[model samples]
Target: MYRLHKFLWELRRNPELAERFRSDPDQTMRDYGLNEEEIRAIKGKEFRKLYQAGANPYILLFGAVHMGVPRQEYYERMRSQS
Candidate 1:
């Protein structure tokens, strides 16, 4: 049920919304161990960066925690940080 790639790509498309999450992306970036700078850096890149094979660990974790992944999965991924 997780269209993980599509959802992440959408987040790539919409950066302002991404900024809203920036203050605390860590709870989402938990398993991947990404920090705010890397999260902001990845989002700050041009659109082409989304298409690159270099999947941002932040984006991957963000989608899994915020958008496409299941609510249960979200809670599981975020519980400790919560």
Candidate 2:
């Protein structure tokens, strides 16, 4: 969970890393040493699952944005999950 948060925060803060992530998310996540569950949640855009798993909402939102999810779509998905 700590590693997942660190990766999310880094994805939020670093443009180059964000670009790399946009290009090859699985590889980038693997490079970050994220577990399979973390990678699955992210790659599947399961923001609610991430939140339920203890990820910070702000970091998740920012990371989702960096990953090309529109704010509206993120919110809609979150709401639907609830």
Candidate 3:
């Protein structure tokens, strides 16, 4: 959601933050002030949930890439949920 952009912005702007997030998402998300649901969705790699929760598409894509999830996998997950 609005918060997702904040994460994305941080990731884009701060290489150290990105590295920290890549290394420890749970802690980083918590430190970054994401709510429980947002942290859950991110930890679970539930892109569809994140998307439905209002994560920007571009930011979501960035998150997916950061998580090393393939674009095809993201689409499949979205389609399965749909």
**Per-candidate TM vs. native?**
0.25, 0.91, 0.79
Runs in model 2 deviating more than 4 A are: none
**Residue range 27-75, candidate 1, lDDT tens digits:** 4443244555444533443223332445555655565444335556544
Ranking by lDDT: 2, 3, 1
Model 1 score (lDDT)? 0.46
> Which scores better on lDDT, 2 or 3?
2
How would you encode candidate 2's per-residue C-alpha lDDT over 1-82 as one tens digit per residue?
8888888889878999989998998999999999998899899899998898888899899889878899999999888875
The best candidate by TM-score is 2
1-82: candidate 3 lDDT, tens digit per residue: 6666788667766788888988998889888788888888777778887788777878887767766688898888867764
The parts of candidate 1 lying over 4 Å away from their true place are: 1-3, 26-82
Could you tell which candidate, 1 or 3, scores higher by TM-score?
3
Backbone-clash count (model 3): 0
